[model samples]
Target: GEEVAQTPKHLVRGEGQKAKLYCAPIKGHSYVFWYQQVLKNEFKFLISFQNENVFDETGMPKERFSAKCLPNSPCSLEIQATKLEDSAVYFCASSHELPNQPQHFGDGTRLSIL
Candidate 1:
């Protein structure tokens, strides 16, 4: 069956270190997105991709965050030089398209910076 998968439900990192999260979108889905939820509140859009091409990434932090959708592999988001404020739930979602299709979210990768 089709489902979004995320591993390492929880992660702890020291300040100035790096954190990497993974996501596997449902099969046949063409659009993938990444979001960050701080304190389990509002979701902040980080990036979106159509197939292997990035559609939009304006919401992503320029300095330390990077993401990619690779063929035959689950999508990944990497954070460099983690900070206290970077602690949050990182969710991966996938949809057929952005206009009408609803995105399915994974349980999320809970990141804690200490």
Candidate 2:
């Protein structure tokens, strides 16, 4: 498919709940991007991967937040023991490693933590 496929448009979890979001990047695209958005503001890049390996994770939270890109599987961002501050729209973009390929994005998963 040409577009990134994200599942469950909206998710609600209570404090200390475990919330998992899924993103299937455009097929054959080797690079995937992840970000967290709050109040329609700037995107904060969380992590990115090429194929199944981590390329950069400097922006990712040190704890309670985890993500994975696995072979033959959709990429995922899982929030463990979610906090009220964890609420946000998590977006993922994908493209080839080349400099000019336009990145494709998924309609972010809105995670609401109460």
Candidate 3:
């Protein structure tokens, strides 16, 4: 079976500081996705990558967030200049891009900006 794992189930950071989250997607999956769920609301797509190349990042905030998908290494999402509104659960998912292939998600890294 395949799985996605994320570290630091919860994180607290002050405004203007930085927070980094990590994720390990299932092996053999080429597409990695990152999403944010704010206040238990909708899951907003932040970015997606295919084999280290960004496939879509139109939904990502241009100011404070960035992500990377690397081979063998766990994917990472880093937020700089954190703001209170930046708090949310950051989820990492992976899929094979095949029909009926659902994306597998991690428990997520909950971030709190104060």
TM-score of each: 0.96, 0.95, 0.93
After superposition, the stretches of candidate 2 with alpha carbons farther than 4 Å from their true spots are none
State each candidate's clash count: 0, 0, 0
TM-score of 2: 0.95
Query: Candidate 1 vs. truth: CA RMSD?
Result: 1.0
lDDT of 2 by residue, 1-114 (tens): 789988779999999999999999998899999989987887899999999999899999999888999998999999999999989999999997767888889999999999
Minimal lDDT window, size 10, model 2: 95-104
Give the per-residue lDDT of model 1 (tens digit) for 1-114.
Answer: 288999779999999999999998998889999999996679999999998899999999999999999999888999999999999999999997669889999899999999
List the candidates ranked by TM-score, beginning with the highest: 1, 2, 3
Q: Deviation in angstroms for 93 in model 2?
A: 0.5
Q: On residues 1-114, what C-alpha lDDT tens digit does candidate 3 reach at each position? A: 368889989999999999999988888888889999996778999999987889899999998889988777888999999999999999999998755789999899999988
TM-score of 3: 0.93
Q: Rate the local accuracy (lDDT) of all candidates.
A: 0.92, 0.91, 0.89
Clashing pairs in 1: none
User: Model 1 residue 54 lDDT?
Assistant: 92
